[model samples]
Target: MGTSFEKVHDYMGRRVRGLWQRNGKFYQQLLVEQPDGQVAPRRILLKSTTLDNCRIEMAQKRGIRDQGEAASEPLEIPSFAVCCRRYFDFHESLKHGLKRQTTIDRERWSLNRWQVHFGHLRVNQVTRVMINGFMQKRLRGGRNPRTVNIDLINLRQVLKYARDCGFFTDQERLPTEGVKPLRYKAPVRPLLKDEQFGLLCEKADSSANRSGPILADFIRFLGFSGGRYKESLRLKWKDVSFELRQVTFGSDGLSKNGKARVVDFNPALEAHLRIMHARRAPDCKYLFPSPQRGGKDIPASDLRGSLFAARAEADLEWVGFHDLRHFFASYCVMSGIDFKTIAEWLGHESGTALIDKVYGHLAADHKRRMAQKVSFSLAQQAASPAEQPAVAAVQQSPSAVLPLPTQSGESAATTALAS
Candidate 1:
């Protein structure tokens, strides 16, 4: 077996970072961390040679330091099932990359289903055709493309590991080379309206199970803060800094992108937090302590059961915990908050990409009102200074220039032109 020594170059003849090519096949060099806090260089074969894929993998593997030191390479070739287990074993020993238990758990979930299909086959026997068949079967069985793509991702990682362990010869083609993820539009979920939130709180407050009031508080907390449910579940009372007018989302690297963020107080979030603090159980550390915690102190694991009841009573079957997050983001947009600032509050990266795509939907009335604010030309640019008064008057009295849009949404100018 040859050590990865060749540095790969893109079409522009520029040297790429941590990317290497040998014999027309591309591989990415990763610094996998050992349990003892030292990192070891492990060059893994890529499923595809495109720079985009390499960059995506690189981002996911960031933060592990590489000192250009080589690690002991595994020499064992195993079945797909064994490879899956070993893959997890390798991640378990890592102090850096794949360090988050949440990410590992998600990977395990995806790989478990993958192993069920390819477990009996040897690592080398897993081919592109078989992978396509599995994906087709999953889609036929009513699984969405997003989930199927996740399965493919985990499988690709195991295959890469198997290749590193000398499972594949140099001449054989990578099985995942031609496989593309299924394209499907992400559905835009409806946000929880202000009135609906009030109704939900009312229903929750009236619950007979004594669980209703807590559920109301949970709703308000999420609705105001735009927090992911899991992050909010772990939020402690001490994380709240009234002096700073903000609540930190627990320890650093606890968020989705693995960074701690403090949500500054809005009127609703401030009011909700204060109310919860006043009524909080004295011995509890978490803001929302579990009523089930008799002796052992712990936060409530979930509020789904009570949410189901309140949702039913409020007749809002489409509402979800994440909808509260959408509610916060959408309302922020409506209030003229910038996407970058909102993204910071929500812990999103890459500027306003995710914000503009997912949470930027505005209410119809809001959109219409904003549409009224758009001007195609500057007053000075559009006309001479002497004519500016007429333009200004026309702008101020839009109905005089052209009658307002009618009930059917046609302007009087259009009506006159038609006549």
Candidate 2:
């Protein structure tokens, strides 16, 4: 806030500051003499937010450390290192199980990489330009857009945490806003109709012969339910309610977002599941347990292997299991189901963006069909009321309107029967 270094020097003329080093990093805490003659430890620790501003303030005042740790010695500016340990501790405490361990690990890795890049510099010395420079360096180093975005996200989160904890006086001191990262296109690979049938037939027949009906039923289950790969893999016996004809997955199981939803079962899947229940071991917890490893979780690799073998046997191309879910969604759309319904079935987070990205084509087709229906309805309304009755009567009695077939299997008279 001082216009000149003399002003800041005169203001902090008599003050006591504490200094210490930990984890090869030095930190300083200082008490300033206020205008009212009151002394207070208004800590100005350096970090990504205040790094540059703090340096400017220090240089302006020529702030110095007392040599003898007492009032008798002249002051000298002390070099303080940014405490990454402190930053990480604070981050971990704030996160506190809100995020997964893998996520926390990623954040830590991002922070560490940034620290290694500029760790020796005081936290208060960080500036928008320096931050931008770091980003440019990362991009030049061949980091992908998504990776760069994640790093920025992690950094922003840490900076926000620091601000909330009063580490930085100015919350908006860091330039975290308006930094846009590139987005890549989503890869969609829906299974073809023939591929779907072949996968089913191959899985069913192979597993049936190998005493692995559970594996066969599981493949069929995914196709019918359109559940996510993890959701299908982690399904337990209790999750499937036979009487309700639905499989419910919630937080206790593999529902990642801790959301509970039910997937309705078709007749084919229901019959298959009924047979499975009868043959399943009474003590088995999982609906599809590992055949060789008792009491252990089903192996994702084994399922992939089975799928690969089936694909090869059926002479079908390799496709991810997720494609089956997409195929199911496409089928639903083609069968006249609405986007909202499809979204619910797939457990997708609702919004226009997801619909635009995932089912945009289906939505456009739906709109076209709706427009045609509206045009037809308007035309029918403009016609005579008697014509509407005749149309309704014909629809109501197809047998009465259709001509009977003769013994020779030809129509007797191309004429209508009694109406």
Candidate 3:
């Protein structure tokens, strides 16, 4: 058959005239009549070869045109404030199971600052330049790089959620991806000295404050176990195995890494835990019961206040509760325990890189003691010069020594020896 042409009609009965195939190639043409009644033809080369394929292509084009027309009309996009609310709602939904209340609270706090600045704008209108401006404003307001980076991270999450929900067009880039976080150096928070720890504990025990003894025990427990503040505070009675000398950090996202970990108890921690366990009330489920809140886990705020008072009284104002954990890790490293072991004990899922970065510095006394252990010299010999091999060789060989080739292809014996 000669190259055939056909008219294709869409569902609306609008016919696309110039649907034809020649030499195994299909073509589509649209003829529009102008206001003056002159016809202008617009041609599109369709890659299909058969008449059926041409008809299908024509239908697809019509559907795409309809979609384009619909897209051209205005559609309401939610504002940044609305997206923030939705993000917070999503986070709140995940609370009590996948996420902790404290985590959600922090996210909300970080995103609130964003809402204050970008709330009026739609999610798609928050561009990278705007984010960069926000970062600059934060930095100008005396916020640290780490804090600003956290804010950016929170904003990024909200925007991503909006994009995924189809509030933003696919072509829009996330501001978070375009903005780079500022680089910052972590401050050095060293471990407390033995005498300092002793003084703090002594002061804590002697203080008239009701939380004094609790603070002392908590400090010592942290020093012994190297556990995080929340990890130790949330330690349940059932999670501790006194007979096995092991404590498990588990209670649905209790651990910082969101995975359960077992920490072996040393004799010190074991003895202290036993004492606490024995004194614990029958109705109390927490290992460290709150003195103020009866039966509940001790609030961190209480411990923090107690810790501050104890530190002041003991003249260890620089020592924080986290220092106790650092003290534990420092001792472990000085005792020749490998970083991998320390990381595992600290409930780190990743290996020793973090441990090495934070706890790599050894105390001066420990360094000096280590230095004394390294010796290069051997014991002095009682042999006389005549008994020494070098002396005997020089006396016996005098001028009859064989030349040994040197690395430079020269005779070693030819070079004069320094006296």
Candidate 3 off by > 4 Å = 1-75, 95-97, 278-283, 293-301, 363-368, 374-419
TM-score of 2: 0.60
Task: lDDT winner between 2 and 3, please give it.
Answer: 3
What are the root-mean-square deviations of the candidates from the true structure over C-alphas? 14.5, 12.4, 13.9
| lDDT sort, best first | 1, 3, 2
Superposed model 1: Cα runs more than 4 Å off: 1-75, 95-99, 164-173, 361-367, 371-419
Candidates ranked by TM-score, best first?
Answer: 1, 3, 2
Q: Candidate 1 has which clashing residue pairs, if any?
A: none
Q: Give the per-residue lDDT digits (tens) of candidate 3, residues 1-419.
A: 36555555556767646675455566676553322336666455675766567778766665554565443212335678877877777767863555566777898889889888888887788888888888899999999999999998888888888877777667867777858889988887656889988899899999898988878888888898888887788877888887788988755466776888778887888888888887877877776667787545444345898989989988778888778888998998888788898888887676798887776766445676676555423321343433344334554554446457578874433342222
**Candidate 1 global lDDT:** 0.78
- Alpha carbon lDDT at 5, candidate 1: 68
lDDT of each: 0.78, 0.60, 0.74
- Count of backbone clashes for each model? 0, 14, 0
Model 3 quality (TM-score): 0.69
Backbone clashes (count) for model 2:
14
Q: State the TM-score for model 1.
A: 0.70
